[model samples]
Target: MNTETFINQNWHDANQQYLSAALAVVRGALESYTTSLPHPPELTAQAAARQQAVQQAAAAMPAPSALENLCRLFELSGFERDLLLLCAGMELNGDFARLCAIAQGDAQKAYPTLSLALAALAYPHWDAIAPNAALRRWRLIQVGEAHTLTLSPLRLDERILHYLVGIQYLDERLAGIIEPVPQLGELVPSHAALAQKVTAVWNQTKTTTLPIVQLCGNESSSKRAIASQICQIQKMHLWVMPAQVIPLLPSELDNLIRLWTRETILSKSALIIDCDELDINDAARLNAIAHFIERTNGYIFINSRERMRLPQRLLVSFDIQQPTAKEQSAVWQAALSDIAPQLNGQVKILVEQFNLSPATIHAACAEAAGQLAQSQNNNLTDILWDACRIQARPRLDELAQWIEPVANWEDLVLPETQKQILRDIAAHVRQRSTVYNTWGFAGKSARGLGISALFAGASGTGKTLAAEVLANQLRLDLYRIDLSSVVSKYIGETEKNLRRVFDAAEQGGVILLFDEADALFGKRSEVKDARDRYANIEVSYLLQRMESYPGLALLTTNLKSAIDTAFLRRIRFVVQFPFPDAAQRAEIWRRIFPPNTPIADLDVVKLARLNVAGGNIRNIALNAAFLAADAGEAVQMKHVLRAAQTEYSKLEKPLTEAEIGNWS
Candidate 1:
């Protein structure tokens, strides 16, 4: 049909069949305004006849009025709808008389107002709807802005609050429901397992609108893909909720709800909330979103690494992970089959180099194929290797070193007593699975449950190294926090920064080693002024996060006494590193040289007399090795002595004959 004819027919069909209570609200509004017009009203016999036809169509509807249907579509009803109609009608014609005429005998007593809305629109029965009532939500509908109810352009209907009174809660009906669930070709197996569980719950309940499901892990795409997959299967649109954009004003949230509802109904699509990437650092915003999801009609899949609680709503939870080895192998073969013969050992090695999803692997292979195609060459192995290397491009700069290690607990040089403490912390983390879950500790409190440690020592005494060791032992990544990057001078910025760190690392339990933590975690001073209060606040903030975070957090400092005693009380483990004795320094000097470094015979006992920490010893050893390499000679006692002189000069310490007496 012609566009004009098609459009006319569409509107015609809508008029004949879509005259729901939602429409009645609009009609009532129009009717209220029609009476006040200077022009002759359109309420003749013909208009009456038409209104009767509209009412017949509305009654014939299996649903409520067009107005009520709109409310239902957006999860609003009763007082909220009435409040919306009042504002909407008032908007069409800025007259309170129009609103008063529409509510005619409706027991709302007065017409449209903030006070009236609070008294009648809000009800305790519908906690989910009016969780934030008028008293709590003054910003939603502006009261008497210049002596009149707010008539600002609405983000959502101002009527939902008014229409929600005495309304019964409605369960989402799944039968005959159509939704869009996106096709996420393949993801890591752990995510697949979680998605499978979500599908089962959806099917089991026979519900179209899903309960909140969180995919907690370090893998971002894994959780996102599950949401996409759910959307594809359910025939829904994927709207990744923005971090800072969610409205704090109740009116704006209501408006968003309307917008989403209109889009869902208009397109017959579901919504996939990509909240995993959203700013979870703002507790207010995060909490607001969690609440928003509960009130939406379409299926909602929230992607976050942390366990988020949805106020009063209960969600069927799931955790996502990368695919298993067998799954990864299948993905590699599928993605690289076209060029498998051309790649020799590179394909197998590439698989081990990357920890990625089937989709990511396919993307890598496609990239390789594209690059090879451009080259006009059949050397596919080079392309695959390039792709593999590209995928593993280090996420952090030298600002943090991620050591994939070969050493274990035996490699650490702490004393015997300290070693047991280190092992005990490991034991807590290792057996926490059984103890926390089976022994009822999980239910007690999330506070003070995370594995946190305070490594007290001078610089270069292996505080960072110990963190790396623990991370390697636990099979997790180590994120060495650059204190310069995290400690913010601005208010709320510190929390925002910390939130980003925690949120980003949520996908996996990474060891966050806050080196030189003294800059941020100093003793909480008495609040004599605003700056002092804010400083204490920052420390208290970190303390709360350290207690609640599910991952491992480590703090390193030279002066443990500088830390607040209260803060120290919450930490699970404290490791002290005393200055190494002469014998211990000998061991450090012996091990400082790498296997590849050429070293001439040197008196280990004499080198031990340098009187330096492990850090200094390593620096001296490295400088001496560089000196020897330049001279094309093996590192010997003379090179060590020369390096020690430079090290002492840098430290501003005069070399004493007692220490460096036999240096040369």
Candidate 2:
């Protein structure tokens, strides 16, 4: 027979033996009560034989009997074991109630009670009925309302009853609060190594107390996968509970911990407290979770984005990051085994561009396969790239604005030198892995390896457009972060916000355009107070993250001198976007209007006389087009002059004839 079939048969036989022993005990108790005397010699012999039969059957089984395992796990006595069996029989067998009625001498008292067990069963102890006893403490058996402990009706817990019948499942009471973690199929090497370390720790600590494992990392899914793998290796079921949902009240928290501990013992389970969604500022919830972890005695894991401090208990922390580039390449190869040969060269590009986990890589491959199956003409590489973007889109969408990159090189009006610098930035990003990994630059050191640039100039000098152009050139997503929104007056809040942005963008390698950076990245000031010290700390933290970020992080500031000197030294490239001269302004005007727009005779030389940057010229051009459309005429010099007056008014500057003279 197969292993499953053999196990099922053995389980069946063990239950029958246990049932036989329970029935024998019930028969002996009933006979003694009916005869109003001690048990007969033959009846006593049969009870002894039944007990011996159960022991033999348990010893012969391939695995330990569920009933026996429960008893041993809970450290139950003989009387307590028999009482549990009696309660279970009442639910599993039809004749148990009749036997109980005969034993109690009253048909109305059909359910088994403590008084009946004491009078009928051998080696019974009154202390078993205490509140701290195995049955009452673990909630294995429920005692009904009664005036006396002896007369209280006993019923088996539903979960325990099902377990006794070889039907294992989670307790109904815990189902709402906890969920079973599914086992991962194939683990990356790094994750597999983590699982092995966790298993070793658990085994080494089996004799002693197991420390609460703290999985500190930014990737929640990877941590969970490792936790599940570790539990599987240790032959334990993994259940997840969100830390935020933990009760704040002492009584409720105590009850929850006790219940979970009991369930752990009964079901060979471990709990993974997911604190990724937990708010660290909420002290009450954190305290409640800490208390729960401190009091519970079982295998436990705390999943948090950062390492949390719990002074009450010992913790073993593991930092789990995403798979390395080589490992990710392996994942891509394994996932797309069929198409690897056709697209061999692009795998490295995919891995370098999108630092995806194994699970995400597999999912992206599957998505591509599905699309390919639908349309055979679809480009597999493009589909995979788009799928990777979709996977990384949601988290980034929540923290910043995703700007669709529509501006190209021709659309940008920067000088050739600045344009070349932008192109070089893309080249460095594209070839980083080749130089750092394939070559030996990374082996030497990792300092200042990140590709960061600064676009410093006046507003409307094409800083934003340049960012979009680079994003389009590299075929990567661009996210615009307004530093005003990210900077906070509250201490430590700014770092928290910045960490979220970087972590979310790490996987996809999205280009980050931090606009108006001077608001946050100003020169450090003297330590006048606590605010000054923390402000400097925030700036230091930003510089560190920028130097270490794997993707391209671009910062734009209107005032270049406001940036700290140390930060300026760390930047790889600082491109100065100067105000457009008359020549550049004239070129911007020539290309500002689309071919579709109707135009009357307009003199570019006069329009170029207006002293404005590229951004204002485009604005004036669009407003002039709108004006001409309303006036039922093509855009002429008059419309352009009128629009210039409106623009100058909005800028709070006087409309001078020196710039716009002779335009009409």
TM-score of each: 0.51, 0.91
The global Cα lDDT (0 to 1) of model 2 is: 0.85
Best by lDDT: 2
lDDT of 2 by residue, 126-229 (tens): 88878899999888899999998788899998988888777888888777788899988778898899899988888888545679999988777888899988
Tell me the deviation in Å of residue 390 in model 2: 2.8
Backbone clash count for every predicted candidate, in the order shown: 52, 0
Cα RMSD to the true fold for all candidates: 13.6, 3.0
Off by over 4 Å in 1: 1-181, 184-267, 270-403, 406-411
